[model samples]
Target: MESLPEETSSSSSTTTSGGGVGCGGAGEKLPIRPPIQPPSEKYSPLDWSAYFDQESDVFIPESENVFHVYTAGKEGPVVFCLHGGGYSGLSFALAARKIKQEARIVAMDLRGHGKSSTENDLDLSIERLCGDVLAVIKTMHGDSPPAILLVGHSMGGAVAVHVAAKKVLPSLAGLIVVDVVEGTAMASLMHMQKLLSNRMQYFPSIEKAIEWSVKGGTLRNIDSARISIPSTVKYDDSKKCYVHRARLMETEQYWRGWYEGLSEKFLSSPVPKILLLAGTDRLDRALTIGQMQGKFQMVLVRHTGHAIQEDVPDEFAITVLNFISRNRIGPNGVEIPGLRRPMQSQQ
Candidate 1:
């Protein structure tokens, strides 16, 4: 895999290339471009690389998959973040910045996503994905096992449930699943299939690609799209164009049985879990608060869509930090002092 560009400080100004009506000089102002909408905030210099550290590579033996991992903070309980389908580890850039101060944040691109290798033709099953996650947890812990908190979104949430069900991580602490529920997953999957079916496979310029990404989906936050699009697309020197890092067809294949029987596995697991939903309207009426009362905590993030972390990152980070800090589980299967589950609400 090609090495990512070196990291730059948050104060640095990064220029956009590919000149056109929408593209301009470093300080030039332009009209809002369709598809790739300009960010809501005042246009300042933007640099996506400043959000996280340089990427580190990891190879998972169980899945025979090589992953691109991005980490922050040097010490604290391990917090592993898994991104949703068609998204990379960089999707957690904003959340990582906030959570790293409290915990060791480790986010990775799952097999066939981001800079990770998809050439192995490995089965993208939930079991294999869970194994990949377990490998990373063990590798991070080294000789002695340490408590780990797993946070996942969308398809990633399903993967986290499988991992929790396996109960392989003796030091596993808790779980936070974002914007995905077993009851609503099939509908979400159908929507994703329709969207990917019509998505552009290749673009002649990076600006066009970015524009397409911003306007294509339910994403309302242009700033988040700007940060996310760059990492998801790469310039192909051979083809003289930019293409998605992961093929749309391959991503769709993985969704075949992604949510089947996940709710049962998630609720039955003994691990402490939190289900963070983006919108209550999209939630399955069948899965009520009563059912999840003791099994898992459910919180609703209002006014946001599927990408809860991106749309409302500060709240997302704070919620996770509060959840982890309050519900900390020690290695001896005992709750740490000052740890208590936060009251759930539909805020």
Candidate 2:
């Protein structure tokens, strides 16, 4: 489901930490000194507070479910973000910094991920996820909800389409799906188990996990990995290391359900939409045809993997700001300068 991890290079320089005895002014014979090994680079875990302005748990009334959320910006349209499988809300941390200036952001850790607590945490059904989003939004904003633009990446993209198709959010103003296509996602499901197996099962520390996520191709940006990967793992007392927070292997039953009919649902949703991809090759028959007819805006961001937002957060944020500005979909409804107009829709 993701591109092969990009190779990273490191260099080591030998340094003498200890001084060896040599020929002094007394003309003593020089002694042989053993070689000194260079120290390994150290990776450190970053705090979420550095990127996001706030973090809170939205407790659903009359239920044990408590969804963890991160937010920034005080005004403008609310961009509700959903992260991919195995990722937490912090996945959007880097992008939030650039997005907050133009609009508000609300990123949530879906059930079974991060600090979220739910009765049946393993239930990743599309329907269950949709309901969770609606419930949380209602609890957070109530009847007078602010204008909302739903943004999702990978598996979260599929969920976003389904949620928008339901047409429940009266204030829903826009949709932006990042690096996910129905055809590609469905086809990739067969190899998903193998991909999951290849990942390191445990790490000695959160820093190591972050390091692996960057070098292993799961994430391309180390800064993004630093802020995001920590939330995706928990300290395992039994193994004495950090392990994945979500049990992805147990939710195999819901994999297909997440992506099936994604294209049709996304195309049918009546709203201004944008599809952002790492490469145009990901476009399927439906999306390709739809793009030809100007059904939705398609943007290609080169040199990125599946985690487009995390891989190139600054660019991702600008694309989003341009989308919002082009459609005039924010609370202030102001157009951003230099952004092109939306493509003409086919009648």
Clashing pairs in 1: 36-211
Q: Model 1 misses residue 167 by how many Å? A: 0.5
Clashes of 2: 1
User: What number of clashing residue pairs does each candidate have, in the order they appear?
Assistant: 1, 1
Writing each residue's lDDT as its tens digit, candidate 1 over 164-220 gives 777666666788889888777876677876767677888886666665665665354
Q: Please tell me which predicted candidate would have the highest TM-score against the true structure.
A: 2
- TM-score between candidate 1 and the true structure: 0.76
- lDDT value for candidate 1? 0.71
lDDT score for candidate 2 against the true structure:
0.86
Q: Work out how many backbone clashes candidate 1 has.
A: 1
Candidate 1's C-alpha runs over 4 A off are 1-49, 61-64, 118-122, 188-192, 237-239, 251-253, 289-292, 329-347
Candidate 2 residue lDDT tens string, 182-268? 999999999999988888999988888888887777888878887899899999999998999999988999999999999999988
Error of 2 at 29 (Å): 30
List the global CA lDDT of all models.
0.71, 0.86
